[model samples]
Target: MMKKKLWSLGIFIILLSIIVYWFYFSKPTSFPTNEQLVAEMNRVFPEATASIIQDTIPIDERHVLAPFISKGDDYGLSYWVWKNHKWKVASIDTKGKPMLWKLNKSDPSSFYFVWNIDPKDQISSIHFYLIRDRGYQITRGIQHYNPKVQMGKRVSLQEKSYGLMQLSGTWVTFMNAYNKVESAKQYPERNMFFGWIPYDQKDMGIFPENSVNGASYSNGEIGLEYLMIVDKGQIEIPR
Candidate 1:
């Protein structure tokens, strides 16, 4: 009986040690420096040829969004995540168009839109939207209609050229409820999408002379949802 007790204690100690290492010791204590980040970018993606490390914006303790300027004068974005005991480049985009990063795919509150637009574009403001198209369907003698959803939040970009925006509470709540419905699973094509429109001081949508025209590279390791450039006619006008 004493021998069996000792064996059990030994197994318990081994399990405890593993848990401790995974929770605390396995992760890096600090984030990588800007120089190190630049090197890592070039190392992982040689085509990126990142010239300057612009900013390191922390999404949470474990995730970071770093925007950089490439040798080709392209404003770019890279996503970092501390996983498997090291900071890894989760995704990289050579063109810095506004993108939705879903930190937790299951949680809408954790979703954020990040961008590093070139200052020369003169983007005075941006309108971000969460849109779902109206739908009609008939199945087994049942008729169903889904109304259009078009929620928007506008942000002033006159102060800065690069930034991040979290999903509003209304957006989060609506997405959560929408995700639970059967239609969301059945007709995934009708699901909501994120989009944006940049406007000048005159409130007219800026033609994508520089912002949207670019060739980009991505490894597709993370969920970086595309933000469609919305047209004025696509949005509803208030009476």
Candidate 2:
């Protein structure tokens, strides 16, 4: 009996050691090279026909965002995540329109909006919004009214065509508070949406010339939420 107990203890120690190594030390310490990224993009999305890798932006130690240009002159975006000891493409978009990527779903601060808009569109800047429409409901003879909430952030595209914008502190605070409310859980449809409006140098809103119509693909490893395009009339203008 003593001998059997000693053998079991030894096996348990070995298994724990393997688990530790696999979870913490097994992943590659370095980011994938541009060549490796291009190959992976081609392998996952042959339709992209990716020809040039524009840049690799590291979101964290294990997550990366790469913007690329295809042979057909399409601006595209690909998200890479280090998983199972190898770099994997989490998602890809041929149009490279603005998308909300939640790196850590439970934490609002980890959310980011990333895009690679085509220069031909003449987009000088972008206005991003976090909005929740007002609501009125009667539940159990109680009158409930939810006020419309709207928040906006503008980013210039003059400096660079491809970039990322993290959720503002105000937006994060609102989201954190909303998530705690019981009503939010009950009415998921009433939750806020991420939207955007592109403006030209003349400060006029215009539909993007290229990205509006295109074919896109995703493997669904990561949830890349599409941002709705908002018309100027839809937003509240300050008096």
Q: Highest TM-score: which candidate? A: 2
lDDT of 2 by residue, 82-173 (tens): 87777888887887789999988888899999999999999999999998878888989999888888899999999777999899999999
Over all chains combined, what TM-score does candidate 1 have? 0.87
**What tens-digit string does per-residue lDDT give for candidate 1 at 1-239?**
99999999999999999988886668566989989988988998888899888889998988899988889877788899877677888887777779999888889899999988877777888899999978888989899888999999999888766789999999999988888884557566546788999998898888656556555555566777888998789898777
For candidate 2, the 10 contiguous residues with the lowest summed lDDT are: 182-191
In candidate 2, which residue pairs clash? none
Per-candidate local distance difference test:
0.84, 0.86
Q: Choose the strongest candidate by lDDT.
A: 2
- Clash count list over all predictions: 0, 0
RMSD of model 1, in Å?
2.9
